[model samples]
Target: LHPAQDIPNARGTALIAKVKKPYTEDPASPVRERQSVGIYADWLPAPASFGDYDQFEGIARIPGQISWRFTMHQVQEDAPSWFGGSPWTGKFDEISSELTVNTLVEVRPFNSKTKKAGQAVLQGTLQRCRG
Candidate 1:
């Protein structure tokens, strides 16, 4: 079974506040192994507001890869004020209300030698991690 099989088409963006270092279960293995990374974020909806904040902590894993880049942008509720002389400046401030999260993930087989990807399987549950 593979990791990406069960992930339904998820849409919308979330604010990622923290990203942990990538770790693997079998660290001593010579071959490529699955690496997991922890991410803490606040998921917001289209009309993002303070009242609609949902705190979430998720783990994203990539098989056979040591490192990967994930980027997140800060979305503020208040729009920045524009000064005179700027193009189309007339107290206009509505662009900051858009919700977006652009992430591109490429998953490959654990065995790098194989050109095709293996069967995709989705596993794992969203649970609260307590101290």
Candidate 2:
């Protein structure tokens, strides 16, 4: 077995990306708009910067004999125009004014030493949202 096998098996790595939940609130909004979420994985460095709509693009890695790459993005919004003036709305407006991020995830394997000892990486860009 290689690091790739050990990382997820014996070593065991877990990652969680969290954002403030208040940014997705609106009391009278009925439409569900996109929310940007900032994703931070384990053992990886902070992203240099995100692009338009808080779109973050690059390689996210696990950093081992067999590595994986990933890309992420995020955003936030109060409520869409379509949700303007509605009775069946929740308190999504009272939510904090923060960017709601939408992160896209993708994965692929990379083999260096041998085909059997291949690695996997996740990559993608974040979608934009209005706050």
lDDT agreement with native, every candidate: 0.25, 0.26
**Candidate 1's residue-wise lDDT over 23-92, tens digit each?**
4466664542322333322222211121222221122333343224232233343543243110110111
In model 2, which regions exceed 4 Å deviation?
A: 1-54, 58-64, 79-131
**Model 1, which residues run further than 4 Å from truth?**
1-109, 124-131
Error of 1 at 42 (Å): 28
The lDDT, on a scale of 0 to 1, for candidate 1 is 0.25
TM-score of 2: 0.19
Model 1 residue pairs with clashes: 2-121, 5-120
Strongest candidate by TM-score:
2
TM-score of each predicted structure versus truth: 0.17, 0.19
